[model samples]
Target: MESSDTTVVRASQPPPVQHEFALRFTSTPRGARLARRLVSHRLDEWGYGYESPVNESLTLIAAELAANAVQHGQVPGRDFRLRLTATSGILRIEVTDTLTERVPPQSVPEVPGDAESGRGLLLVDRLATRWGTCPRSAGPGKTVWAELTDAAAW
Candidate 1:
């Protein structure tokens, strides 16, 4: 959704518009699904889609990030926030949950030889230009963010 807040520019020039979308969802499997769906829609709106390799890569990244927030950062009665920010040359995705101390493992977890789980962050790490976690600016939780640059945006 569009934000009402605006940034002022020179009187002679219109303000630069930034594309952004933010939403909070329950820390559940359903929430993660919705987050991924919305991101895919937004990506398509921004002209990245089935034919664009960037679309497939970033869509998977968003899904993995959202899933991590639900699986590792879920707290009773707490919801997670997924925010999307995009410009011509960059796109950033951030997922925040009420879990200040539950940072992602320092390195991607290695799955056992026969295990059926543990690859989300591995995919994120490989696909994103950069990804990391930081304490939320004004809350008890932390935010995990990843960015994809111009080279990956096309």
Candidate 2:
């Protein structure tokens, strides 16, 4: 049987050069893990696989943002949403959680060498072309987003 993680896009006519997909998953560590894996799988299916640097960078960004949502923004019984959109040469990622009050700190603190936590956003800042947060259009909560420009011709 085909796994729920796999989504196949078929074009009745000519396929557009751009595509998008969005999903919502439970706000938990397991869900966060699935989000990252699904992103890699989808990118592969989209012809990026793991060979492209852009796809690799996107995977990393998705991992960190999803982890942050599960760790910092999770609210009991609520789910987080992952949105991926590719247009022209840009890929945009959006992860939204239920807890709007616990938004991630804009600037990561400079911790000592022995510090073990607090580097997720730092990694995101370094990898994503651009990223930020905004209030959810539906209601409460906020959406954290990042964009990656395709390294190859699209």
Candidate 3:
């Protein structure tokens, strides 16, 4: 029997997650290396082993971003920050540096005929599902970020 009934369906939303790891390091070679190693250790603790492709790619991504922060975004007397976030099988890595300019390139840049470098972002682009840059949320700087799924595309 079809009576006058208007059934209202309410969609459910999952509870918010606050899983995040963050750190600050000086804009130096050692600092970039530390960021990379820490990312590997943290991902392993989070259930992704050292040999896991997801961990490998994420660590590389972190290294590249941190290196960029030190090489291109470095500002005198300013430090860089690394933030790792994991939620629902997604891992996000962000490296923020004191320079507001010098956004990370979306596509690979054309290298000179005799150049031996300038390919870090190309690696990041290929490994990450998505990557981009943004102004630092709490400082006068910029943050370059990349996201990877549990099954990373790398």
Candidate 4:
């Protein structure tokens, strides 16, 4: 009887998949609050629950950006916009408002330790992997964006 040898080979597993989401809202205090809540809810739906660091970070980011848009970028009769997108490794947050002429200060000025204002972007800078602002394509508005790396696992 002839001896027979068999070789077994397995296919490589595919990489983990990623997803994206986006939203828009008005430029108002209520709108900002809604944006923050929606971000947390959406993260929960995406499997990053309230307890996840990613969800927490995203909530903070949404709150700060949306607040800035409403407080600094608001234009009468125009609405702001909030957008969130997530992939396997990255999550991006964007807030757009109607005041193109009034841009966020390039660097937040140093404030007295007890001052209650001027800390929103500072928090964003410290937490986001990358963040910046750009003029909107539709005209007369600006979009501020931040990205979080390792969003799925974080």
TM-score of each: 0.82, 0.84, 0.84, 0.83
How many residue pairs collide in each prediction?
0, 0, 0, 1
1 or 3, greater by TM-score: 3
What is the C-alpha lDDT profile of model 1 across 1-154, one tens digit per residue?
A: 8779788786675335368889999899999999998888887887777557777777788899889899998899999999888765778899989888788876787777787778888889999989999898777999999888883436
lDDT of 4 by residue, 11-61 (tens): 977444465566777777898999999899988998889988889988999
lDDT per residue as tens, model 3, 87-145:
77678999999898777766777667787888789889889989999898987889999
| lDDT head-to-head 1 vs 4, winner | 4
Backbone clashes in model 3, listed as residue pairs: none
Question: Highest TM-score: which candidate?
Answer: 3
Best by lDDT: 3
Worst ten in a row by lDDT for model 1: 10-19
Off by over 4 Å in 3: 1-15, 110-114, 152-154
In candidate 1, which residue pairs get closer than 3 Å at backbone N, Cα or C atoms, i.e. clash? Answer: none
